[model samples]
Each structure stands twice: as C-alpha cells, then as structure tokens.
Target: MAERYAISSGSAYEEKYGYARAVVDGDRVHVSGTTGFDYATMTISDDVAEQAEQCLRTIDAALTEAGGSIADVVRVRYLLPDGADFEACAPVLSRWFGAVRPAATMMVVGLLDPRMKIEIEAEARLTR
Candidate 1:
C-alpha cells in the first residue's frame, strides 16, 4: 500500500466534520469539496464569479501544501445550486484552468449553505 497522509487548511469545519482538506496517497492528492469561503474570516461572497475565484485559491493552497500546484490538477468538479450561475463564473474558471485544462465536470446541486454559490473539488498528481 502507498503511504498516505492528510493536509489541513485549519478551517473550523475540519474539526467539526472530521475531514482533511486534502489527502495525499503516493503521488496523488485528492482535495475535498472546497467552497468560496475565506477560511480566515469565514465570509462568503454572494457573487458566483467572485466565489469561484476564492474556491480556486483555496484549492491551490491545499495542493501546494501537498507538494503540488494547481497545474498538477488532473481532474476538477464544479458544483453550483443554479446552472445559470455557471456562465458568470466561466471566465474565472478559465483563468485558473486554461493552461492545465484538467478533465472537468459541472453540476447543479444544492450546497450546505445557501450563501455558497460554488464548490470545487479537485484531484492532482504530483510532478514535484
């Protein structure tokens, strides 16, 4: 079996929910569903585009802590409560993923919090 470990972002939810921000097994890192909340302040934006930006930022930090970067992301999933909200965030998503161009999927689903406009989950293979 490959050696594995967990990485945390110090989000309050981690302790309350008992889940790591990311898990590294061998050279693969799986990041959990990350939202747009500014973990430090626990605030979220109402705008979907702005929220998408924060989601990538959070995922990037987790990937970095796992010894990889967003460019290493191989798969990504975008979750939103409204399908119409996705277009407004397309440019933001392209900005973060244009070059890496990971396999992707987008789905409309109700999130845990109504304030959350977007949630992103990613998987990466370390090249570092």
Candidate 2:
C-alpha cells in the first residue's frame, strides 16, 4: 500500500471542517479547495482577480510541500459564485497554467463564505 501524507495551511476552517490543505498519496498530491485568504494574516481581498492570485499562491505552497510543482499539476478546478468573475480571473489563471496546460474546469457555485469570491483545487503527479 502507498503511504499517505497530509499538509496543512493552518486555516481555521481545516480544523472546523476536518480537512487538510492537501494530501499526498503515493506520488500524487491532491489539493483541497483553497480560498483567497492568506492563512498567515487570515485576510482576503474583495476583488475577484486578487482572490484568484491568492488562491494560486496558497496552492503553490501546498504543492511544493507535497514534493510537486505547479508544472506537475494534472488537473485544476475553479469555483466561484458569479460567472462574470471568471473573466476577471482569467489572466491570473493563464499566468500560472499557460505552460502546464492542465485539464481545467470552472463552475459557478455558492461558496462557504460570501466574501470568498473564488476557490481553487488542484491535483498533481510528482515528477520522477
């Protein structure tokens, strides 16, 4: 059996929700839906684009700790409550994923907090 590991962002919600920021099982890393809040400051921005950037920053940290890089990402998911916000976030998304070009999906759905304009999740296979 493959060994499993968990990484934490130290977000309050992780304890409240009983989850880790990301989990590594064998060579694969699965990142949880990450919001815009900077876990260190517990602050989030109102602008969706800024929020999108923060999400990637948070995910990147998790990925690096899990022994993977953004380039190793095989899949990504974007979640937002407003469809119009997608366009605002596109440039940030493209900046991160343009070269890697992972399988991607976007969905407009209610988030756990209204202030959270966006949430992102990702999956990566560690490079051998």
Best by lDDT: 2
Number of the top TM-score candidate: 2
Tens-digit lDDT string for candidate 1 (1-128): 98799998888988899999999999999999999999999999989999999999999999998889999999999999999999999899999999999999999999998999899999999997
Looking at model 2, the pairs that clash are: none
Clash count, one per candidate: 0, 0
Tell me the RMSD of model 2 versus the true structure: 0.7
What's the lDDT of the predicted structure labeled candidate 2? Answer: 0.95
Error of 1 at 48 (Å): 0.7
For model 1, the stretches where C-alpha displacement exceeds 4 angstroms are none
Q: What is the per-residue lDDT of model 2 for residues 1-128, given as tens digits with 9 covering 90 to 100? A: 99798999999999998999999999999999999999998999999999999999999999999878899999999999999999999899999999999999999999988999999999999995
When summed lDDT is taken over every stretch of 10 residues in candidate 2, the lowest stretch is 63-72
Deviating ranges (above 4 Å) for candidate 2: none
